[model samples]
Target: MSDSHPKVLLTGATGFVGGRLLPALLEAGLSTRCLVRSAERFRKPGTGGPGFETVEGDLLDPGSLARALEGMDAAFYLVHSMGGRSISRYRDYIDRDIRAAENFVRAADAAGVKRIIYLGGLGETGDNLSDHLSSRQMVGEILQSGRVQTTALRAANIIGAGGAPFEMLRYLVERIPLMVCPRWIDTKCQPIAIQNVIEYLLGCLLQPAAAGLTLDIGGPDIITYRDLMLIYARARGLKRVIVTVPVLTPKLSSYWINLITPVPAGVVMPLVEGLKNEVICKDNRILDLVPIRLIPMEEAVCMALAEISEGPGRIPSMQSCLIRDV
Candidate 1:
């Protein structure tokens, strides 16, 4: 690749956010290389595109990753082990993420990659953090271990199609007329649209200011899960009541989620536990650095609904399943 048009390596191209991001990267006229576990999984027969390549590699395999990272200017680390059956054990989840990140970072460093961009969860910097958030933070730390500059974009609930929180809200609202809400349902969270998130990720790729910084990304509004349910109910023209009970623990909530939604107990438990922490954005440093118009909650919800209604585009069902499990 020419110096003017740097080659970028992207991990998790078959994932939910990565699936949306691939078209955006192509549209931006950047040379892109995606790493997938299976070559067949990354193949798109009819969609002909230039400056796009796919290579079979796993984060666990250092040799394949080193080859994949060769000649790449920048890399995007978008992989997470949220859907894995072993995520129920906090130590296993942390170990997997840390090891994967370490391997990727070492490979990127050896390939002389300029930068690494990571997407992580948003939560307070305290010992009381949920396991999911803790693992995300640890991954960010692991990525920074190498000499390559890393940018960590910590975000709260991302409101879009194929996201866990949004799908959970959709299932809860669509399945039950009345919700027996958990205590965490009232906790505040800042939600950003999938569009805005894509913009932020791409912005970091283009903006020099985003290098080696941990920036918080969120929407213009902050609302509780209950408030979100009410908005969704209003949008769908459904009347529903939420009865909050302090007795419903994360374990109990996971069991209920398994029964009500398509999400499994193993996946839902950690996500439910994470809801205990309020994940609102702490500062707007990213907004000042990489300026992009933020989308409102209602508009974001509408766009997600439209995308869901339109059926699948380039995004795969496996990606959707993985996202819901997250």
Candidate 2:
């Protein structure tokens, strides 16, 4: 670690979590460079944020990645492929995600980047793991396999405005009075608020104890997906009738969700499958390393609703057109 402020690189800076994290890094007085395919999307020509700059790069492009990573102390790997626009494109997400991770690892190692912090999906690892969960875990493993000190923070269903899960719940609950859901609604999940997620991420950057560790971070409440929807319904002051049917498979659920919510069937595939497993935190080491009062699920939903009052979700036009991995 450097004695002075560390220079960090942020990937997926325009996505849900990355967008929120960039400003936080800048506010903390760290020189943060965002890696983007198009720099113009991050800032207008000849204008930039204090302590922040955008580098034209892609994880899949090794030459560009090396340039973006050069002289960086640490980096955040927040990039994720949301299946794709159509079913055919969705088929290659696992391979695409893996290749990108491999490219990143090689680039970071060659660049001599000391630390890599990654936000990965939370789920049990085994033969039963969903394609989404397995791919996420594989990406984390890929980052850790490199020479750098990697901190992998696994989280389930991050609840906040503009997030895919929140957006799905927002549209589904707001639109349908009678919601028909699969039986997996009873699956337990420990979801953290976006603010808490950012704090934990910053903690991993500042505190060396978090390096080379895989940790789980979640909220104070460990509840079922059904409870999550009820909480949202209650917060919105709307009464929803949730019907759970055993016959509905994950594929069917995804399609139904796609039909009703902004989240597309492709995006919902992994999400609904992820819900089939219990995603509650297995340990709280991250809290011990970087302590904060975890927000309650009800409060988290209320806060998300407050942002909705500000207007529609702030996803880019393309991202909004389909459901995304939260």
lDDT of 1 by residue, 166-273 (tens): 787888898789888779889999999989999999988888878899899999889998988888888778899999998998778877876776654555767888
- The alpha-carbon lDDT assigned to residue 20 of candidate 2 equals 78
lDDT of 2 by residue, 168-281 (tens): 887888888997788888888898998899899998899988889999999999899889989999997999999988999987777777777766556766677677878878
lDDT of each: 0.81, 0.82
Positional deviation of residue 33's Cα in model 2 after best superposition, in angstroms: 0.5
Query: Which candidate number has the best lDDT?
Result: 2
* Clash pairs, model 1 backbone: none
